[model samples]
Target: MNTVVSYIKEWQQALQSEIQFLKKFGSNKFLVSNGRLLSTDGSYSYYFETTTSLRIPVGSSVRLEWGSMSQQGRVLSSEGKGVILALEQSFGDLISEATLFHDPWELLDHLIERLDEIKKDKQKRLRVKKLMDPSMPANHPLEKIKSNVHELVLRSKYNPVTFVWGPPGTGKTYTLARTAANKYFQEKRVLILSHSNQAVDVLLGELTDFIQKKDRFREGDVLRYGFGTGERTDNRQAITTTELLQNQDPSLAEEKEKLLEDRKLVKQDIARSFSKRDTNQLLELETKIARVLEKIRQKEIEFVKDAYIVGVTLAKAASDPAIYEKTFDVVIIDEASMAYVPQAAFAAALGKRVIICGDFKQLPPIAASRDSLVTKWLREDIFHRAGVVDWVNDGRLHPHLFLLEEQRRMHPDISAFTNQYIYHSLVGDHESVRKSRNKIVESAPFPNRASILVDTSFTGAYCLTERTSQSRINIWQVLLSFHLIHESYLSGLRSIGYVTPYRAQAQLMELILEDLYQEQRLNADIIAATVHRFQGSERDVMIFDTVEGAPQSRAGMLLTGKDSERLINVAITRTKGKFIHVSNQAFIRRHVFQGKTLRQLVEHQVKQLQTVETKDIGKWIKHQHLKLQWMHARKLENVFQDIETARASIVISLPAHTRLSPEWLEKLNNREKIVKLTVISESEWMELRPDHRVAEGLSFPFIIVDQQFLWLGLPLEGTKEIQPPFVAARLDSEKVSEYLLSQFITRE
Candidate 1:
């Protein structure tokens, strides 16, 4: 058994023994309020209070004793106050909370013992083979999988523990599926696990579809285990092995159908009694339905023992005693980065070969206490810890670790920023993702464009409370994001996602989006979630609201960690076509010294904007009607060649500082005699001050070739550096060219 499960079992036994002892000798008559306990026996009463507000820890079992009856319950609290002391009627009324007390420190002692064992175990060290299978063909099943070279290398290594570093949109699930399928096809029993049931279900669905398409496995070969009733009923494809077994057995299937039908009848009877307000009949029917459901559950568990390939959530799989008896050849853990180290270890202990698939750079494991030593120690996943020392650095990956570089989800525009800032430009570029197939009913103002930055420029205000260090949403940001959503909906671009760093902001956005959805102003399926919640998901368009707007305060504190950088990466990469970042530019600039990813992104956007404005090359080419000329002193031969192709006369100009070869000057002089060639120099042109040049439509060393085409050569000045020392051509603008020529010929 794994250390965590063993510790849990020991704790449970200790709790049970303590409960038995308390029942035998402890006081029965007690009063409880606000998680405080006061024992009262006849005339005497003793109130037990601590220095701090008393809190009953969640998941700790509580037992109550009265007369001949003993009842067990759990403590459910709100802000350290025990709201429901007794919970159920069987547990009786509020009793002494002191009797319910069990220090988790005792539980931690067992956990500490386990941690020590893990630290000392040399067998737990990750091992990898030095060589791969040389006989494997080029067209092997693994090769057919569209994964990166890193993934293929990792799959080749015969490692006890292998890690797949899957950044956002990097096909982590697909890689896991391929690996698991390969193992299964090789006659190896595989156990697939994940942090959440949803993740497990997704992997299971993908695997089942993949194997079915290949005709490699029978219908009952792979089984989904430990899914709850709702999950079993809702997902037909992911029916538990027990359900499949029951269906295959004629007697069991009939009995199960009869129970379901009887339960349905009871539900129908209860619905009818609700109209008549018959309380007794409704109560009896509800009890009948509950009994039938329990029977069905028990029968399902009984048949699950025969499954060959099983998929389950980590906690459920670890807790199942039957799983410990059977060893699998390979255990595949999806979303491994989000699984706590101990939880992952528990899952990893079940298999000889462990494969962990997840992106450590997306989101770390969630923890309850940031200050606790145990919590802090357990926050880092095994995959992340392994990567820290030996994986994916300096263009070389560890033999056992695979870094998936090709992201097939986000558009190149959306992925470029994340690729450069987060992945160090190691991610592969798939140009096909740039074209979004989402149907747009109405074209937005900026339709089918690259990622954009919506610079709010410190227009919003942020709130930070003492209760939490994180900043809350600014009302202005919510309004601005809502406006964007409205515009997106109007433009027919649906599948929008709104992501924020703060929970309060996400909640507010959710409310605003819901209202807009109800009013038919926004898409009904729009999602608003925090960055952590939005990880491992994607959308057609994503709007990020960086809630830190306060410039004077230490707003930088929130975005100053590797985790924050990962959050920013996940947020920006979730969109396929458009990434709309809403942040205060002034605030970001002020705290840019913090070296946060968001600030870096904003700075990149700023540079891109400046480059686009200064060098409007596309705008120049669009207006020039295919008749354009580029002149440079270093490339005079190329310029002469370009001038020779002009159907009409060509005009050439040079600044005072520009020096040309005598051969080029003779070639230009000869061209002047052959065709209408006009050459002008800065000194020969009309003299005008910098301010007057714009009004006169005249620039230094100006030339008007073919009467209709104008080339203005302006020198680089101030902060703007000129390339080629030339301005864009003006085509079909005779008036502007005529004015410049008239002024140039008439020297002052």
Candidate 2:
């Protein structure tokens, strides 16, 4: 199959998805209703201030609409209430107030433009000739992928597209930096770009460190010419473009001042013209201004032309007219999995040779389109779209793909899980991790182990959700987590994270942890967030709250959907020292049988894995025998089996006047053990007694059998004729039943 032909179709789908994303999250999601111009960086861009706190990521494109004038620009930088936008149209004056919009169309337009050019390009050095069969000539041994990135870049003369799959903590960024710096030493122009601004700064910062230590390098040689999230960088001040033009080079600075001053005078002269020949004079003056602007553009280009390494976001490279004028020997995309197809395509076209770096098993581009084709082409990263994932899964390695598995962020045992389960044992941890495994401090529950599965079934921490919301929360689990987190804190593990699939659980933990840390005056570094928010980050200790055990009894859609092993892989592999997974063992096993992603998690954690984080947290572990089923529309026969088989006790929360069936009575009579039973009903219906309890505003229609099995959702005890058409799910875990009983039984 012609991969370029597919990309043409994928390109169209991605544009459509971009439209859908904007339509869905346009005005409300990104609103700058009232903002003012703060300052201008150069003739090409203006710095604006928003009235509200804005979190627009750097390098995002935005639209400014006020009165009859509407313009688009790239956000060069973004701070709390300030954003610097490099607009297509420049203004000498600033507006006190204007409405700014967040539109990604401009970013797509650049990609589309570059894609069209790629389709027309004929050179083998510029574009991949056989995209379906990409190759890297004279590639290094698989063991030296991390060490030989620069050599691969130099050796891949005929091949244009090369991919590097760097899993978490594999030092991909460091490898990228070393490659860029080494290329600089060889006098090769290197352009580094990423999907996010923060990533740009991080890479630029790393690049700065490496180049600064070099004997031949000096300040202003490498420039961080764009906006990133970080307010500060370790790079020298002269590394910025503004610093280079205004301070680093004296001759360029003098020429820029003269041209700008001349342009300013000409604009004033045109504004003052009034004679009958004023039109001619105005045209002449405008011509003068245009000439001076060209001179300024040339000088700016000259300043950039001398730089060996330039770092920016893909949007910046696409939007900045200056970028299209230049070419690079090597183009590197860091965190490429988070990049859209167009971004990668555009960057690929910018350089004769390309290096796309990322872990496809992590986050892909975050788009809101539900179209399957759009999701495949627009949302999936380059590695996925180009069949690297397919080849790897089929036990075959792609010629163009290089793998880096020597990670130092996770323990060897913890890395083994992702190594065996996620990557199919294709790569293993480095010796650093192997040696560091035994150095772990014996923290309370996590003594000498890197990972643990905290089975909530035995701890009475049943999962729960509200009547109206799907964001599940297990209060008992939260409490147990907080206790363990606190223990880890006291044991000197500072970098901790409590991550769950539900926002409600994260928020709840946030509030409690915030209050507790403040109350104790403890300097806590713990973070609680959803699974998606924890990507591209690592922690010394992490608690994976696999919230699943409620009545829904199903795994998360993002966890069980197509190719969802990536997300689950990210969730489980973000910890370095210790990992704790709190989940309902029975629910996942019963309901998570369909998806390969969730099933692998179950088989690996429930059966194969043996290391438990902490034995102390198992204070509530108590195994009890039970049986349960889900019945819909029909109860079949022996509907009262829960009551009939109760050996210890039965807590029936139903109408006081309700009577038992004959089959239940016969079974109870035949049992040798005397079972105690309590009936809970409305206060007005039943008086407070030892056998009969009165409850106010409490739900009752559930029967807790020996505090192990729970009969819930529908009343199957009444006559079959009076039964309503309803669905019911019987929980068979002892801890779940006890937890449910505690929730239903009102003591006050």
Candidate 3:
């Protein structure tokens, strides 16, 4: 780690390790194409529709590029397949040409290449070591009450790196913004960074408003460096880096003009060359024009260095060239838990003093990588790499870590569970959490309790779960989310969030939600985002859909690791009023054996929760807890038992490889009344039961006895090719059964 080459090797490995492995963990990388103009606000923001809906995590920092013209925007929300982007600048000339989108991660290699040079600074290098392994003793939370520890940390000369474990709704952004504002007012250079552009905007919105009201931009520049649009704050004065260089800095503006002139000349030269039939010169001229544009970009970013207080995404800060030229008095990295370790290192290595603010218990970087090199350093959050999170997990305190105990967001009832397990008696509820006004139970969404777990087990579990390759879909969970969302909408809740672990599941649920919105069953404001994306945003009513009954012997990667704990904690803490996790208790107990987060939730919360069972589907469906028709059948005889009762029709879509006992089918055929039995399986199964057609691509199999609705099947020990005697559950609801049926069978 001493040599730059060695550090770069390890860093590069962390960055590239996922390339060689199948990504079974982390956030789904955002990549979608062919965006067209949808709508504009007549001023700044624009919405563009992509041809296909990607599981684009809303609020992600995205770049919309067309041919050569491009603009950066923060995704405000998604309008179906379209994304509502608050662009840094309006592209009025945007034509119907295909536009492409990419994430901020695309530009990070430049930052990585520059890190070695950054480490060349002796003071900064020493600071990074101190940050990585600081010997500073942790101060008591009472010490923060007694003294201005927040301010002290911001200005600390000795302890260069500080950790603030800011749990959900703990005013992490508020505290950081105020502290950053204080630094700016005190004439200390401060750069505040977060993992996402949305987070940056949120913090900057608070900081800008507070500072603007205090001094009204009288003394210094409180600049928003990387992003163009700040919808919440008045961005007219504190413009972005490009805007500042365009209007304020005379030298950079002049350079831009010269570059523009040079580009114009190059274009003219190309035109003249075309007229003269000088085809070979075209490439040279285009390259010259590109160089001029690059020079122009370099000139434009010059404004990035002069800001008194700059707020930007960590990726933006690291990759932004002007940031490399300047050093800050303090660098505060908010959302350190979600942030990659290198992101924290970028801050720790840049500033003389640093404040790493995040809750390690919350989700880490959603990396698809499981490599030890990447997991230990690159993808893991700074809190984990620092080993303080381990200390807390082991019932020990890390000296330099400051754990924020009091949360003002969740009601006392909801925060009670997290305080006991996740925080281990270290955290408490603020008085505001206990306020009668914050009584969510008194509200419409959950009339009984502040939180509840819709145990899918008691609600006639399905033989075949609404699950796909990545545990992406549990139709019951998806439908349950839709039902809850609809109920919340009817009850007059506008800000509702639905969090799931898989991006595919989120996108699928979004489709159902869109259908619900179309039918006027739900509002357009309801957003279905991944657990990773739901952080930093508060909702009035929230639903955490843990994709249940993972088909395999192992519950998917989403339910394992400390990252899973973080995901659960974040989803739990995001709700201000009411929260419900539509979960499969049976799966968590048996399959999630490696993880304790889900098991603990079921074990503890169920004791206090009103056990809403599925003995009757009609009643459960009304409340969004469905399933009664489909029954759990582990043995083929149990499946035969249900098939015998089917007087109308028997639709069988079992695993193609399943070797059904011939006697079972013979008995099924010899029923008192000859009923139509449709077997949708591989061609081989069709050969045995010629009454049915072939289910070409069916993976998980099931039988819907006397029902048109499909019941999914999962064996106790599931495999790609599930053998006999696998455990499968039943879903009885007719709603969306046709949908699940469509996936299994190809109708003639």
Candidate 4:
């Protein structure tokens, strides 16, 4: 590791080694250097000099990884075990501070001069070339998982394509960024794309943060480096947003024309079918056709905008005429599962290299497309049709890189639940990915509990009708609570969702949210009417108030199929914390089908116990305990089993247990639990518990009232004897005394 480094006294001399590495080995060499740095959990970077005294900008990322790398050399420096990162500064600002450092062309000129010195010394040039080559394992310190993928991408240079699929909190976005950054430093222009506006915004924020770092490129330098958007005004990318709307070029016009023609044909077919149908047939056709036509139109509009915006933006930047000019050396697309093949093709056509990233298990395109867009786009067009098969087979962009593993984001308990419920395959071998093993799982399991009280006969169809006073009171109570609770943020907050099964119920839910907001001060942003409107969407807190209007009939079970699944999913997932289900407890007891109860499915085990057979009985009990529906029961049993297994290593003593005495039972039955069956005179029966309050004792099963109803507590049914906990009452001030006296004192 001895070296005779020559000081040519120029910036070009400082970067001679890096420049030589790039010219001989191409962009892959630089990728190897940066890829290693990008893998770290924290940020780190270094500014290094070549063998010829040329200066090159090299940064090591320490923030992205969990640990640090041991000392290998000054080539890749470490702060203790941690990596080093180059702080990003804007070009305009950096240049304002130090003029010479901001000029890439000037730096380029100096570095070229320094290479001339290396060319003069044959042995020195050879030694530097060997170090600059990135083929050696020691050259890159990326995590083993990432390093393997990078190598695959390098080997498959001709036509590389990779798929990284995992559930939420898996650091999917971070992996995409790291791969893109690695390619970027190699002087390869890269593109980052996302199917969702929210996804795009999030990735944009992350990239902006990285670019704004002091050691990283300055904002101005990034713009110069093709990383910056056109311009910003009102906190938005002004040029890009404007151009996204008005890309009225011929290609765009052609796509629009095709869409309109397709719509016309679909409409014509629907009309023909309607004309030939009977009244009933025509009705069904009308509904189906309307839905299909609406979806088609939406898809078209989304496509036109998505395709036009990115293409026009890129074209405007590269005003040059070369069709195949390497505008971007590498491109990364997020939410690729939602990206159609045509959209991906359009992006691929513009970039020199491309990377598409998304989780297929989460969601695929719901647009009118007929295929798996990601698979078809990558394999057929990029590899087969384009004749980039060799590159793809070799793990190159002619191929692409696919990541299978995951990093961080979800707690083990939540992740396991999602995997079992949502994913098609199991998450295996990852020891860190397991059910929550903590002693304390939930601090607030039942943060908010609501009980619904229904009338005796349950025939109250007017319970949900807006015209009724009851409905108004219900709405008002919810409105008051919404105002009182400090809930929901407008932006940068977890979403807020509401869901109901019935169409009218859904409509009422919306009315409730809007009315409450109008009547009170609510700083909420987005609200959905039903589960369908909120599907594939998440919120921080959710409120579901079941509407009661249906009479007792089989048809009353309105939730079924996708609607049922959608409602359950929506209600369960809407809150990262507490989920509120506000409906009458009586309604739940009456309306919900009994057999459907999750707990009832567990059958009670009947097993025989005998002397000297205690061990076998215990084993059966243990298995039965494990099968119980309650989570707490399972936890307790597991703990007990663990203790028993540990205790098996040593002997323990037994203590005699005590039994209840006959005298104690006699005292409890005679005095503590005495029952008196007395027959009072017909009129006198009404007088019991004189201290308690009373109501009209309506024929209704339970007392029913609206927001205007207010009672202190349950009242006594009579003016004599023992008291009861609650009394049914309708709170109307004008009839309060009559209603109370009527229940306790019978009319003469």
lDDT of 2: 0.65
Best by TM-score: 3
How do the predictions measure up, each by TM-score? 0.61, 0.68, 0.70, 0.37
lDDT of 1 by residue, 1-748 (tens): 2443443343334334443444444323333432322112221111122334344433444554444555565443211112223233432222334343333333333333443443444343221111111122222245544645334434543456666678777777776776677776776788888877778877777777678678776656677877532344342343465557566665655654665455344434433432233334333443454565566556555544555577887766654555644667788888888876655665665677677778777778864433343343346666544443234555666656667778878767667778887888878766565554323311452455556677655232333331233346554456557666766765666678899888877876676554335555333558889998987678777888886665236454446565778788878888776677877677777766646787788888777661122123234222211223333323444445545555566655454454445564555455534366545544443321111122221123334456555433322111011333333322334543453355344544
lDDT of 3 by residue, 258-345 (tens): 6545534543443333232322333344345456556656755654555688787777676666776678888888888887776677
The worst-scoring run of ten residues by lDDT in candidate 2 lies at 617-626
RMSD of each: 21.3, 13.3, 10.3, 29.3
TM-score of 1: 0.61
Each model's lDDT comes to: 0.55, 0.65, 0.64, 0.33
Q: List the candidate numbers ranked by TM-score, top first.
A: 3, 2, 1, 4
- Candidate 1 stretches with Cα past 4 Å from truth are 1-157, 228-238, 241-246, 249-304, 387-390, 393-395, 436-445, 458-471, 519-524, 610-748
Q: Which of candidates 1 and 3 is the stronger one according to TM-score?
A: 3
Q: Better model by lDDT, 1 or 4?
A: 1
Ranking by lDDT: 2, 3, 1, 4
Best by lDDT: 2
lDDT, candidate 4, 206-275, per-residue tens:
4544444424442221221212333443533322322332342344444444544553443334334423
